[model samples]
Target: MTTPIHVMSEIGKLKTVLLKRPGKEVENLTPEIMERLLFDDIPHLSVIQKEHDAFAQALIDRGVEVLYLEKLSAEAIDAGNYKEKFVERILDESNLETKPVREGLKKYLLSFDTQEMVDVIMAGVRKKDVTIESNHLSDISEEEVYPFFMDPMPNLYFTRDPAAAMGDGLTINHMAFEARNRESLFMEVIMDHHPRFAGQDVSVWRDRNHTSRIEGGDELILNDKVLAIGISQRTSAKAIEDLAIELFDNNSNFEKVLAIKIPNVRAMMHLDTVFTMVDYDKFTIHPGIQKNNGEVDTYILEKGEKPGTVKITHRSDLQEILREALDVPKLTLIPCGGGDAIIAAREQWNDGSNTLAIAPGVVVTYDRNYVSNDLLRRHGIEVIEVASSELSRGRGGPRCMSMPLVREDLPAR
Candidate 1:
């Protein structure tokens, strides 16, 4: 088996990446369940799958290995005793304990390879009639019922937000909201106990008393020596600080840490939603936050006994500080949404700023964000657009669609 390469840089030679194709879970989102599911609207699964396939195929065409989370989960179930544990974890997290629902869950876990189980785990199992054992609850009538059922997981398709790969292992995030907690559980099992991935170190940052959500979408590995973290609505300052301590406490290769504080707005949910590296010295960014036009702040910390600290108003300014502090050459900033007032505003809302680069100057994007694509094209970057109308309906784009585990650094241009 080929050991997966460690991710040391964003603009690296393409290697292996992970993705979860949208499925029935997306179609199960109803207006009443939208908020609970962390989605603003329901997406057409068929169309979303088609779009996802296009994105995956684009990476495959470039010789990058694309691993599907569903296939991995099914394989894990077949290889270890983790299947039952995963099922029980899901049940406990979702608060489903009725007899019928419990039996249904057991059946679903046993059929991990089937579409039914996939749908149930991703889209969520519906509440059926509740029941109790005759001996256990003799006083309760059948009409009175037993435990309540739970809402289905409609946002599991956003796999990028559940777990993040850092250094030599994976970190299972404690999602900021309850709607996506099931995703974290699924990732935790895969990362910690899967036969194919057994023995790999896995970290879980869950506070029994407080929520410290840290999504992969907000974390970026610029180089082996630097990590750029985004603090936004989905990722908190406390979460970032905790992650920093974890990373710094264990690793000596990392020499600096940079935190880019994004505004807590729906438009800016993660750091990748506003910035991504395209090459050794080049990056794509949203001027609003990257330029400090919005209420965003940038901070940096160096490695030493004292561990010097610095703050700047804009990401560009911060970049300069990093270049000088880390002894790197100039950094380039490519504006997202075309850098035009009207176009930038329009595309940014549609997640134009969110992109996953397969290789230097080559990236995947939503076809809906046309203006951003055009801008990338004009700047000599290759754009492969996925038909994301259905996927975008769920409020995520290319960046949210992928979780890169390994990449090779590109030679300086």
Candidate 2:
């Protein structure tokens, strides 16, 4: 029997992947709440969906099985016959204003079939959409003009942040922000009841129930034996320590964790935003992330002398670390925009460093980053360009958008 979750390497041939198509939620973004919701700007709904469809097609064209999170969530609840239980969980995290409002939202959500129920929750529930029965006439304040009873999950399209697929297991992340925190709840529901993953041996190494925050974008599977998780603005150091301890003490193939630290600014909010694996010997990196001599603050985490503890070793040169970890003779770090001071900063903001590797020496990247795209091609790498006008507005490229479910294992060493 094939394991439901298997991601041994980041640059392995992708067999199956998960994506969330842009929906009405994109249209729900308003200037008033955009920043708080982690959006730099609002996107045009029609164009973004068209761009997203093309992106999905690009994956399908590569013979990869694509799964939609929205479809799976709907099917999971219906298959498990747990509609009421699912709705209750969503409302529980929604922070409804009052008992009357909570009951009203529950009834309205339950009225729809599973699919629409999922969509409505994602698109957000407008204040006027539900009717609440209150004993007093002044239950809802007239001066309270805030739009939504429930906030639209505009960031749902980036499925890579809520959960990460690792060696025969995955992590249901505790997201860093409240706006994106509830996004994991949807994945939790799907994992619990979805037919494809429910009965499988997939392990949840860490779940979203903790206050220590971690995100999938910070998690990278280097090979069968080593993993790279970043200490960035979105993922905390404590979370990485805890996850490393779990892998060290548990029955897992992962033997080491490289806790590399990056700038905490939003431009480099996640590690993948500025660095990603593009091939067995090639990686895309932003020059700005380096110190005086291309050195990054890196630490190696391994099983300690004592049980259930991790041993840490300090390292700086990223190239040396990669060579030792993969046992490669030489590794090339491809610079975004060819490491130009101005070009690197500009394209890095648009996620030029975030390329999704479908196969060794081949990657899918946003076409708008022509300079970076050209650089990858010149380095003897296969670069597949996708439409990016609307997609780049979300501040993520192909790597940030995708969550690989299965990948063909690389031949031993």
Q: What is the TM-score of each candidate against the true structure?
A: 0.85, 0.98
Where is model 1 more than 4 Å wrong at Cα? 97-118, 129-148, 200-210, 290-296, 304-316, 322-328, 411-413
Candidate that scores best on TM-score: 2
Q: Tens-digit lDDT track for model 2 on 52-148? A: 9999999999999999989999998898898999888889998876889889899999999889999999999887888878875544653267878
lDDT of 1 by residue, 51-76 (tens): 78888898898898899887777666
Residue 190, model 2: lDDT of 84
lDDT comparing candidate 1 with the true structure: 0.69
Colliding pairs, model 1: 12-408, 13-408, 25-123, 124-152
- Alpha-carbon deviation at 303 in model 2, angstroms: 0.5
lDDT of each: 0.69, 0.91
Model 1: lowest-lDDT 10 consecutive positions: 304-313
